[model samples]
Target: MIKSTQQSDNERWDGEGGSQIAELAKSLAIEELEEADRRILAFLGASVLCLWDELPDDARQKVLNRELVQSSFDASVVRARIALLFK
Candidate 1:
């Protein structure tokens, strides 16, 4: 099942004895996770980045659409426009 696979992946990621490439793959797997699930995985990933000399491919691509980025951008633009009006 999908849930079991995901759990197993996390377990594998947390396990020891992988090469740098293996660890990178694990981090990439975590990057695609849901936000609630991502919280701890993000910490684990940051630890890997800090401890390991090598990093995985940049985790920029979203597994799904993320509206938050556009929403925040819109808010920031509105705030800037408002600030200009007050200035």
Candidate 2:
């Protein structure tokens, strides 16, 4: 018998990753983190439908500034929708 050389993503994450994330989330300051640890912070903050519920409360508060981003994103949609509708 031989050990498999490859492992699935689930098996990889079944180790200490969850605890590491929890520990990181507890200490993370999203504003500072986003600039410093961009991808990991982003991965922590992102969610389906833009909810970002996975982030810790402190990190979430600092990271989830959707009003401005949402407004800006919505503005583009609104602009495109009305671009030819009215003019």
Candidate 3:
């Protein structure tokens, strides 16, 4: 369900779309990741951010209680912290 939706969102974002994370990452001159890798990462980031954007305001304050958010992070506090940008 959401997986397919996210894949489509990723594709759309890779095309004619603008996002904060992509803008911030675009300024980096580092060669660690190629442009392709950067795009792939950006698409994945869009999926997560879009997911978080759909949540209710109250749930946004305490995402740990939301199974969708928790499962999306897979119990990784570090990974989940990235979504805190919305909070």
Candidate 1: pairs in clash: none
Candidate No. with top TM-score = 3
Whole-model Cα lDDT of every candidate shown, in order:
0.49, 0.45, 0.54
Q: For candidate 2, lDDT tens digit of each residue in 1-87?
A: 134434454457557254545554454343443243455435434642176455467765444344443344343353454445546
Q: Kindly give the number of clashing pairs for every candidate.
A: 0, 0, 0
Estimated TM-score for each candidate: 0.23, 0.21, 0.28
- Candidate 1: list runs displaced more than 4 Å: 1-33, 54-87
Of 2 and 3, the candidate ahead on TM-score is: 3
CA lDDT, candidate 2, residue 86: 47
lDDT of 2 at 29: 41
Poorest lDDT segment (10 consecutive residues) of candidate 1: 60-69
Model 3 alpha-carbon drift over 4 Å, by segment? 1-31, 53-87
Preferred candidate (lDDT higher): 2 or 3: 3
Which residue pairs in candidate 2 collide? none
Candidate 2 C-alpha error for residue 44, in Å: 8.0
Number of clashes in model 3? 0
Greater-lDDT candidate between 1 and 3:
3
